[model samples]
Target: MAIPNEALRKVLMEIEQKSIQSSQQIQLVKAQIAAKKRESRILQLTASEVGVLPSGTAVYEGVGKMFIQTPPSDVMLRLEKEGSDLKNDVTNLEKKLHYLETTYTNSRNSFEQILTRAGGSV
Candidate 1:
């Protein structure tokens, strides 16, 4: 079987674009995770310095104020949920990318096989 040059080129181009988009999305997710993780770390340090539970839940008192330090825990939970969603999104993107790349490779291989059979004649 042979694939037309135009079709092959189109698939290859689409594959490249999809891969680039996926990569960019993965990078964005990583950046978001890093930001959230940094905040979590800072929260941990602050809690440690001020005396609080590291499990993100505990009762503590601050200077002239008896607060339950819930902001960090709340933010951490929200960020963690977001991170989980992004990780799942990345996994889906990777699967789509693999499919697209495989399509391109199969088309290119078919073209090559055609060329070989035709003795390199257009």
Candidate 2:
């Protein structure tokens, strides 16, 4: 038996809401990935600039509002580790964004199909 139009319309509305939520989540993840990419680039540039310094040169790293003298090698190592962590974060966020996008597409398709089956347009 064919489902009632009212029921189908309700389901369609719910799916539409879900699709919108998924789209928002995808946007948030994309923003996070972009921010991480920028941070990683900054770290890389800082490391490159540090590479040109003499071995005896003092390096200072900012901690909160204070800057403490740090070894150049230590600074380089820390920057490398931070960059790696940021890269990993971006990768994970990308995967999450992909999942959200797929979910959103599926929800949208289902919403369209339901609307069509109900002989309606929104």
Candidate 3:
């Protein structure tokens, strides 16, 4: 069946809009991954430094809006757990970004094929 010109135009516009949205989402995910990696590195460095601190040294850790005194070992354990969680979040975001890219590519390709069949430029 032949698609009317108006219908084809609407379909193409919707596809373009979705593709743009996906691109933006991918960029946001990339930024999140970068931020997470940076945080993880900072935590690793802090943990290493804390490992060499003298026993019974005072350590203050920030919790939300307040700083609480905590043991160096406890701080190290918290940092390690947070780092692991961030790494896992980054991995999951990467996978989601990959899936979005694939879907966007397929949609764009289909749109292009339809436009070409209709003698359109895009």
Index of the highest-TM-score prediction: 2
Who is ahead in TM-score, 1 or 2? 2
lDDT of 1 by residue, 1-122 (tens): 66676765665566566656655665665566566566656655554553544555553435365564455555455546665665666566566656655665665666566557756544
* Candidate 3 backbone collisions, by pair: none
Instruction: Quote the positional error of residue 46 for candidate 2 in Å.
Output: 0.4
Q: Candidate 3 overall Cα lDDT vs. reference?
A: 0.89
Which residue pairs show backbone clashes in model 2? none
Per-candidate TM-scores read 0.46, 0.93, 0.87
Residue 4, candidate 3: C-alpha displacement in angstroms: 1.3
Over all chains combined, what TM-score does candidate 1 have? 0.46
Candidate 2 C-alpha lDDT tens digits along 53-121:
999999998899999999899999999899889988988998899899999999989987877776774
Runs of candidate 2 exceeding 4 Å displacement: none
lDDT of each: 0.58, 0.89, 0.89
Where does candidate 3 stray beyond 4 Å? 64-66
